[model samples]
Target: MVVKTLGKEDLWCGVVGGAALATGGGGAAMPREFFDARVDPLIEKGVKFQIVEPQDIPEDELIFVRLGVGGGIERRMQERCLRRFGVADWIREMDRVFPLPKWAEIPDEEWARVAPYRRLVELKGREPFGFMPFEIGPNVAFEIIRAAMLGKPLIDADNAGYRAVPEVSLGTLNVIHAPITPYVVATSYGDLMVFEKFLSWQRAEDLVRHIAITSGGGCSGMVSFDEDFIKKGTIYGTVSLAMKVGKAILDAREGGDDPVEAILETTGGYRLFEGKVGGTTREGYGAFTWGNIWIKGTGEYAGHTMRIWYKNENQISWIDEEPYVTCPDPFTVVDKKTGLGLSNFRPDHWPVGREVTVWGMKCADLWRTERGLRIYNPKHFGFDIKYVPIEEKVE
Candidate 1:
């Protein structure tokens, strides 16, 4: 079996490249606090984060998709769950309720990260062979850490291709008509819920989203025992792709080269626009962050303005109020100088004068299919605009 060990540089690559592919959502790149709190502890124990090829996985082994739903009323949800369960501290209370001898020494935060996966194992009566991220984001670190904690490697693949999507229906598994249930969800305040079956992927999305709304946020674990199903339902080598993109950007920056040029070369993407942040409008509703960014052009693109609309992830862009690029074509805004992808979560990052570059790339072949466009297109997001490939729009 061929295995690749992910070093500190590789992990940082995942953070940077994952954020770039995140399209303005998918949580921020791994923060210093996260590295200190989670990654450092594992390294001190001699645990190496490893990525194994999909073909290397044993036929008998089961793989679980790890997903987290963000954007919720955290403080309110905490109060509600705590009051309902009569516990002052959720993790401490959970230890008292569903004690695990094997996890007795695990820190509370670490235990919370793996709780959903542990619950899945208990329900299935089978330990997972490895874990795969449902998408790319900060969760890339979480998945790697979870797999290492469970003495397993993370498969070099992702369910949401190279970028993160806003809803469950956007996952590759859904595109392939894979069943999502026989899943387990673990909320922040120690609530564990299991779904033995679900009516449909759409309904499952609604249910899980509501749970996230009520619980403030939570992680869900779903398993697939069929190797064939996994192979067909996931995009392979995306983890390596993320690392490659990140390394190229980092290398260019250190060499006193143009990071934007490095990004375009690394991803075969286009420089859609270069400008200063003109303004932005964002709102949090229905457990999702929705917003738009306005960029006043600069340099060669002077006098032209660009607008991007996003529901967690960038969905569409318009140049001078005319459709330019629309989803399932992945696009992002990044700091031109640092080459780091910016997140919508930080309004300050896009202040009026912040110079940035808008980069657009052709999405994976999966998203180009009719079925893929039906769910991911601008029309699906309530925009009347039709889906157009980025290459067609730019070239």
Candidate 2:
């Protein structure tokens, strides 16, 4: 019923708020110069950016999940390379070298025949398929831009709410049996690879991660699915949610209000802890930046301690050896003074003794289900504890 047109202000808000929703992952918030350079050019060419509420998306239409597949400085290098060479030119180069599958449209007849409700099985596509992103992030802009180029509309809902994850198969899309294959992976240097067959979500993720590593730091992927399948499975209303969060922060700075309170009030998030970064350690292997960070409480919470575990984004958080907030629910680290997000991608950027605030929010209802817990539970990430929602654990 309510649709939001994405203007310049909305775009800025979305990026900032979406970075918060990213929960310390989803790549760094796009630099203003990058957005103007990359997205503005498209706008000049008549590209329209609009966020459609899930209820408004026609059920029969397809939604493609678009995401970036790599990390580190190398990925940035790859992105710059990709931008230098246009998509058409990149595709041509990919075809010239790798010669993997190119994106193709799937017809209604083939899509309607998804083999009768099988839960966990390989997605055998009789034809080429596509889907749109169900998440928000730095990658989100690219998805929007690509969708505009391809002439399709993106759904307002995303599988992870605004949260970011390390692997492709971890989202509600995979849990809901949404097919991820017939997906295309494109790198900055113009190498392309396609995966049309995967028996399990892990295999799909593993394969994609491997490709990302080989293809330079990361690549872009497009996975198509029926919009109806993701309607109930995703976190709805994120477009408005992101805008509100972004605006809250901006308003705070302009009005001389406390940015931290602004964010907590807007998102219903809790300021779980405040501290200074003691140190951070992370390593890259298999498409994710995996690591842990130590923060020693400062000011009011002085003498307390906290540690967070992350795979691209913050996933497991512990305070004073007590299980704080783990996966499924989102937790993030924000600069204590500015309230801006800090990424795990580069720990050196955060440095030691930087003041930071940790916040936690409840994950989507979809992730609390028994099925959902099995996918993102703390134990799944090798922790011994069960995940308790941030709302339950905080107050």
Candidate 3:
């Protein structure tokens, strides 16, 4: 049951941020890189951060949400009828109703423009619930320090999307009117202070992006404070849970155990396909640079392969050329090295000539949810279809 940490040094630097980034509009970005940037410059001028998990976030504390994951908002959410998010029922049991809207989807051109800060950047808060992206190492640490001074709950999981996206407003936050004061915030830094306040999250995001463009790409604010919303809206335990999954794989590898064996012991996920990338297609349209992946079977599953597709940052859907998932029930993605998990990282360009397996992160209950239709299932993410009771087992 014991698992390993994300890296040699667990401390503040963890593996959840990237995955958070990958979650796009689904979850919040892991501010590890951003936090790193703030620790110095902002800390010198007074910035702070606190490490807390979903469970640790005080239910009564006023909070705000932020994004480490953000790229674009879907302009045609209503038109597309996309439902890849958690079931509203399950989500309601976990927390308040904060259904996010797909705002503006990222244009591939603009995406290329913001790619640097998009990955491994620190977002700090200064005002009541302010935030700024910090690329430099020192500023990241400074932001963490400032968050600590806020004396509010900084839950480990991002209540918002993953990655350093366009702006905070792009998320379903403002549209849902979930009362967004509990997330990231920014302050002082002079002109940076103007960024501290905005008429709406949309305005704030627009301002921030403009700042980034003006600054050559992306800009980081010294203050990132969003305590109120933390006390109110946002998903709680998902982030910590994601970190736990990654750590489990890392730990299993360190323990000299077959990571897949360890993962199977941990997640009841199904190994839907084991193959190599046989095909690739990139669809770049307006704000989207989408792609599709094809898996050619090998080993015991020879003659059966799978095909997966995705938008710029998410797994859009899957079509098993073999439909083998009927037996596995769900699909999955595991580390090629340990066969544990592909966490934060997923399959992109195949044909690299490597043995691989695709698993699904499915639970029986997930299949019955409103979003249980084709493409929205756990198999969509290439996760094996199985649910592990880690919450109960670990507890």
Best candidate according to lDDT: 1
- lDDT (10s digit) by residue, model 1, range 183-269: 777665555778888887767778888887765444444555456667787889888888888888889889999888987888788
**What does candidate 3's lDDT look like per residue over 190-235, in tens digits?**
1222232456665555555444333223233322324444433333
Which parts of model 2 have CA positions greater than 4 angstroms off?
1-3, 72-131, 187-191
Q: Residue 386's C-alpha lDDT in candidate 1?
A: 79
lDDT of 2 by residue, 277-313 (tens): 9988887665578888999999888998999988888
Top candidate when judged by TM-score against the true structure: 1
What local lDDT score does residue 378 receive in model 1, on the 0 to 100 scale? 87
Please report, as a residue range, the 10-residue window in candidate 1 with the lowest summed lDDT: 79-88
- Over all chains combined, what TM-score does candidate 1 have? 0.89
Per-model TM-score versus the true fold = 0.89, 0.82, 0.49
| Model 1 ranges with Cα > 4 A deviation | 32-37, 72-112, 217-225
